[model samples]
Target: MDPWLTLAVVAGMVLAGTLLLNAIGARVKAEPLIAIVRAGLQLAALVVILKLVFTSMWLVLGWLFVMIVVAIVTSTKRIGWSREVLAAAGTAISVSAIVTVGVIVVTGITGRDPQHLLAIGGILIGNVMSITSVTAKRLREHLQESRDEIEGMLALGATPRQAAARFRGLSVSHALIPTIDSTSTTGLVTLPGAFVGALFAGSDPMDAGLFQLVVLGSILFGGAIAGTVLTQLLGAPKVLPQPPREAEEETAES
Candidate 1:
């Protein structure tokens, strides 16, 4: 692809994304412009970096590592930096990324093609980063929110993990909905860009469908693993703070 064309595409994406952000905010009465703008800047910067990375194999691998580092740091911060939070997010990203890329290369599914390594890495890393971020954030927030109920469960003799059962499971499942919906309504409710682009590139409908199916299925499994595993790790009974018994009972009396 021409460099100018790539630049144009990035510009178009920023324009469209900005408009969409505003529309969503207006509809929901939620102001997330700063959040959306920050995300746009990060994605735009990533596109520019990818252009550089694709020029050489050394840079390509370096860029991949950079993506992992950025994702880990961001996930850690977003989940409210604690030793356990960092450990869980880091573990999930590393495991999920290795699983996704290793399967593709080891099985000769994608053939470890250097020619398309950058493109493939971009897709995999992007999805894994999103999964890690969402899962980490959701787990932490849910854990904090359900701290009282969880302690009550523990007081009732439930194990720590058992105390977190409902909130942990619900939050993790909720985190997977976007991925699940995208996978479910791929062709009908929404034609994914990957499938559309494949057809535009002159691929047969069957070929495009196959590729999309593979990518979507892989994302679901990888995302489910990333979300569920990290949720369990961070939501494990030990992360729950033990409130003083008098404090707890005062609230009960009220």
Candidate 2:
């Protein structure tokens, strides 16, 4: 990527940051100029690092492992359940990996190249990691926030499972929105990375389009299962874990 182009991308990302904060009615505080410089430096560092890492099989595997670890950490950090997060992440990833590899196995009958296999696996794993993280975090937060309503249902003789079921629905659906929108608006509203990247790599339009479609459908299918698993894990912190005390305090203060 060109330096100037990278600057433009950073600018666009900062705009996205502004929009994200503003969407929740948060004020758009001016981000520090050094933040952009630091981001540019980090991008340069990652590019240099990845260049060295991807050249060797051992290093490539190491890089993928690091990415998975980061994804696991990312999922856990966004939510409060410390003990269960790792377990939830590992389980979600395991289920997702099996499903993804299975899909690739079917694709293998058509004889995929090593490159295609790596690319497809990377895409599937990354999306599933995201889905898992988002699902678990949302479920935990919703359940905690809605604790009173949930317990009220429990008081009315609902089981813990029954009490938390509504939140389970809300959180999972909310978590799946991005995947759904990406599927529905693909090609029409936006060109996803799989298609655009394939074309950029000199694949034919039809071939690139097919690859994108297949990957998108596979993600939605596998993500549905992966997301559900993470949500269920979140639901089971103390065999239906209660919300963090901080969350309750924040809600009360508000």
Where does model 2 exceed 4 Å of error?
Answer: 5-59, 109-114, 156-158, 237-254
lDDT of 2: 0.73
The sequence of per-residue lDDT tens digits that candidate 2 reaches over residues 104-158 is 6676631254456556666877888778877877886787677778778878987
Error of 1 at 129 (Å): 2.2
Give the RMSD in angstroms, all C-alphas superposed, for model 2: 4.3
Worst 10 residues of 1 by lDDT: 26-35
Q: Output the TM-score of candidate 1.
A: 0.72
Candidate No. with top lDDT: 2
